[model samples]
Target: MKPSDPEFQEFAEAANLPLLRTARLLTGDWHLGQDLLQVTLTKVYLRWSQADRWDSPTGYARTVMVNTYCTWHRRRWRHELPRERLPDRAGERDTADTVATTDALARALADLPRRQRAAVVLRYYDDLSVEQAARALQCPPGTVMSLTFRALARLRQSADLHDTAVEGR
Candidate 1:
């Protein structure tokens, strides 16, 4: 219930990377991912009392992110065009191939529909179970499976992603 609790700060630090990565995948841009994570964290902070009682606050935060993204989808004005250049990375990569692969994947993911993107990220990236993903998406388990199937199929078929190595889970 404490807004400035040390426990909550520790939890936030531990969850930041995974949450940010999931947000990045969901939004198809690092900047949008930062915003998504900030919004989700703000919501969690506002409900600190309830969140502190949870056994899995990271999962709850992720659910909030998915829900927020879905809410954003319904708002026409929230959609924006992609930027031509990516933001600078904090560290230099040792290899060019790694950069190319990730760039291709990001572009491919950006082309996917929102639900498809969410489904893929939740089910694969987050390694959530079908039921878990379904709950996060507020849909039936069957629907989650369907979305995952369609999303993977689309990703597999994408010409931009054709040359990139994909590992199916």
Candidate 2:
């Protein structure tokens, strides 16, 4: 059960893809997902044995990513806002469009309160049961359900705006 055990590494490897996807959903940016995954994996590596003993390694990693993000947000002044402008990319229309959509999604996600964003990612992206997400988030199941509902409502509103912009283009 020790993180150093060979079995632990195997589990970590198996969990990597889902962890990456969850990270992407949580951060709404591929680059941020990479950074989040790296941080999460490093934490997992440090405590592999203990984490391996958990019923769900994926859940543990998700929790770690969420916590790390929340901690980062707290350390930075809450008033700090993300840049509203997209980066310049010359001669790659496809790449530019993708980046724009990604940035839009990231902005939407970033606008959400941390707990609500975590709830959406855990329930929708990870497809964890309400009970499981509650356990991971250390909140009551009812609270998880409430957060999930609010998160989805907000995301739907953002999606509507995105659709309108695309249709007008």
Candidate 3:
């Protein structure tokens, strides 16, 4: 089916921004995030009928994106290179504090082990329930709870986040 199919188009339009945000967090790179989102959308397009039948289309898309991300993580060829310099920004200097907090959170997220990061993203960022996150991660709900606890602890312990919080206050 074409991407312009009404059902697929509607789902894509509704879920696009949240999917992109989740993808960016999963991949920790904007370009990779875009690529991931494209792959996700293509997957959704191929399975549009089944996806359309899902109770929560956005949740299904998120599951696909997370699973795809985990697959990419397992493959060595899909490496995300660390950048030595920051990307250029536009002239607007508004919301500097918000930007810094986001950057700090992203960096801390990058430091988390893959499963922990996935759990945190699914549970907190995606606002999935423990049972839901567990299903998405293919683990038990208790594991999701533990992973969320540990991930949040790690983020709290991060000196980068600590410094950002101190400076933001």
Candidate 4:
């Protein structure tokens, strides 16, 4: 089916939620995820007719999402504000621990270099093959592997530090 066809729209709509979830996992903010998704959808729309011919539509969307995210990171400086300072909803009090853990993970993710973060997100979160992620990132597969290894190491170190702090407290 052509990208402009109704079936294409249906497929895009059906994939939206999962795409947003993956975006949020990669970006660590709902607003950023929405923005990323919007950008991705716009790119998909522009290339819709061609996208339908690809072997994997979801992979195409993911590559768009990653490219858009990388562009945003490169062109903009996203200010890092402490999560604790943000206003909380009454309902969220019940899920405070979950929120805290997510916040910790997000902070750790933010600490990584952009390419490393992208490698980690694409390889692990999106479950893309190294070759696929390399294509998406316009890098060699060896580079993707290196970035993934470094990112995982950094995340592990940060997690261990967080655990130690909690235990000390």
Candidate 5:
């Protein structure tokens, strides 16, 4: 709450890695994800005083990231292409199967509409309940359920997921 609060700094430090990962998942590009994380963190910092009242401020920051990403998606230049993989090379020990499976999942996730992707990420990746995700999305819980259902259905129908075994949730 206070500008001098060290607790917010600790929260930010603890939340950064997960927030970065979530942003990457949301944007499907590392650079865009980093931008999203920066925007979200700036907003979170501005609201630092009120964040202490929330059940989990980290979760609030995630919600901000989702909102910011959605905004970016809506206004992004049409020419901006999402990358299927990060530029970083894997270590020599990494297997092809692992890389392929990861790419497939990323492609499937990337294909989703912004809202559906947000719902899927919030529900599955972030492990939020439908109600919690609904709050994050500024929608009713039923809408969150419907979005998640459709997102999962689409993911299941994706060529990669269907081509792979991908069983058991």
Candidate 6:
């Protein structure tokens, strides 16, 4: 089938939800996720004529999304306001403990280096194997494994510190 044929539409329809989910997890924000996906899809559509020759169209789009996301903050700042503490406890539907833990995890994720964050999201959250992530990242499988390992270790340390701080309160 031609790359721009109906198959592309079908594939896009099937991929949308999973791609959006991955984007949201990668970005830690829904709005940014949508923007990321939009950019990815636009790029893919522009290259649709080559889709017939791609080893994996889905993989190409995923790699494009990640590369685009990584570059976004480089050219300009998104103007996120950084604060040491929230002025008020928002998103309070959950128990205080759950909310605290979730908040700490989000902060820890934001603090991770971009490559490490990508490794963690692709490996754990997106459930990609080391080999698959390596392909997406254009790196050796060993590198992907190392990146994920370090990311996980850092996350564990962050969690431990958060736990200790809570206990002291």
Ten contiguous residues with the weakest lDDT in model 1:
73-82
Residue-wise C-alpha lDDT for candidate 6, range 38-153, written one tens digit per residue:
99988988888889788888888888887887677733235785778876765647577665665676678777887888888889888998888998888899999998899888
lDDT of each: 0.82, 0.77, 0.83, 0.80, 0.84, 0.80
> TM-score for all predictions?
0.77, 0.71, 0.78, 0.78, 0.80, 0.78
lDDT of 2 at 95: 66
Candidate 1: how large is its RMSD? 5.3
For model 5, the stretches where C-alpha displacement exceeds 4 angstroms are 1-5, 74-94, 164-169
Q: Give model 3 RMSD, 1 decimal.
A: 4.6
Residue range 6-71, candidate 5, lDDT tens digits: 877888889999999888888877777888999999999888888757778977898888888877
lDDT of 2 by residue, 24-66 (tens): 7776666677788889988977777586468777777777877
Top-TM-score structure, candidate number:
5
The residue-by-residue lDDT of candidate 1 on 47-156, one tens digit each, is 87786566578878888899988677532224666779977874565656677788888888878888889999999899999988987887899999998899889988
RMSD of 6: 5.0
How many residue pairs clash (N, CA or C atoms closer than 3 angstroms) in each of the candidate models, in the order given?
0, 3, 0, 0, 0, 0
State the lDDT of candidate 4 residue by residue for 1-169, as single tens digits: 4555676688789999989987887677777788889889888877887975787787788888888887784333467755757565567348766656767788898888878998988888778899999987888999999999999889888974487458547
Clash list (residue pairs), candidate 5: none
TM-score of 5: 0.80
